[model samples]
Target: MRKLARWHIWLGWLAAVPLLIWLGSGLFMAARPIEEVRGEALRRAAVPMPLSGLVLPREPVVATKLALVDQRGRPTWIVTDADGATGRYSARDGLPLGPVGAAEARELVAAAWNGTAALSALRRFPRDAPPGDLRQSRPSWQATFADGAHLYIDADSGAVLAVRTRWWRAYDLAWGLHIMDLQTREDSSNAFLWLFGTLALAMALLGAALLFRRRRTATGRRA
Candidate 1:
């Protein structure tokens, strides 16, 4: 009985830290507005696609998903093939303008942002196995505003992909801690967490059993 109590205490203490971290981080995440963390409120609205003057290629471009996306108030055709190749072309003559550059990325974000914050930093990532934010569009630009807001623009399409704020960073950090992944902060499938969780559950059940035994003994003594 004493041995069981000791094991339960040890396991409970071991599990307490992670449980508290999970609770604290979850509370903080819930307190912050999701929109603010995602930086949606700071983004500029995409203008309507201008299809009136569009001159699409008569010779069909074999693509899986092709559509007109707003590019700095102009209509631009975003083409993606079955092989997952994407490009931005001039709607005027179907001329391939190629991927968007750093300048265009900045322009795209600035035009849409209603905030007075200036573009503080701009970086282009290659389209090959990029970071988590640019995983969908490998080659993308990360435009950081002076207000600590980051706008991810697809390099090929000149489209704003995602907006991230400092609040998001905090939330992301908390999530990483909760999942026990500090480096990439994404590996929730780790075995260590599972092992510790199981131990904690076992500890709780054993403790409950001990309490019930003690209560029954006290009742017998009183009677």
Candidate 2:
């Protein structure tokens, strides 16, 4: 009984670490609105898309997806063909434009940023390492505002990929610790979390046994 109680106490402490991470992260997520964490509130008001003046290619583009997105402050259509070729067309005359540069990237960030913070950092990632949201759109630009908001823009097409804030970063870190995926901060369905969960359950069962054993001993002494 003594050995079992000692093992239970030690295991409980060990299990508490992961449990606390899960609880703490869950609490933070529940307390904060998800929209704010995603930085949706910091985005600029959407511009009305122009439809009548659109001039598609005379040749069949055979596009898989067509998205009307904001480039700098202008509206543009990004077309992805069936063969995975992407091109940006002007909204007014459908003229193709060159790839996004530093100036256009900064303008895109400024357009999306509704906060009072100025530009703190603006860097480009040339298909090397991307943030969680920009994984699909590699070679992007990350513009960080002084208010702890980050905006990611596609370097190729000048599209705003995603917006992230400091709260999102904290939530991501907590989620990684809770799920035990420190590498990519994804994959919540791994076996490592299951192993720890099983051990924690065993510790709880042993703790219950110890409590019952102590209660019986006290009753016998009173008798």
- Candidate 1, residues 97-176, lDDT tens digits: the string is 76777677778877767667888888988877565643364678888789887788888778677777788888888888
Range of the 10 consecutive residues with the lowest summed lDDT in candidate 1 = 129-138
Please give the RMSD to the true structure for each candidate, in Å: 2.5, 3.2
TM-score for all models, in order of appearance = 0.85, 0.81
Report the lDDT tens digits of candidate 2 across residue range 1-223: 9899889989988898888877887887677888988888887877777576667644356789988876665668788888655778777677777888888777778877787888999988876577664545467899988887888877877777788889888877777887888777778888888988988999999989999999999999999
* Model 2: pairs clashing at backbone N, Cα or C within 3 Å: 127-139
* Angstrom error at residue 186, model 2: 0.8
| Residue 182, candidate 1: C-alpha displacement in angstroms | 2.4
Candidate 1's error at 4, in angstroms? 2.0
lDDT, each prediction: 0.78, 0.79
* Model 2 spans > 4 angstroms off: 1-7, 58-60, 81-85, 131-137, 205-223
For model 1, the superposed segments whose C-alpha errors exceed 4 Å read 50-60, 128-137
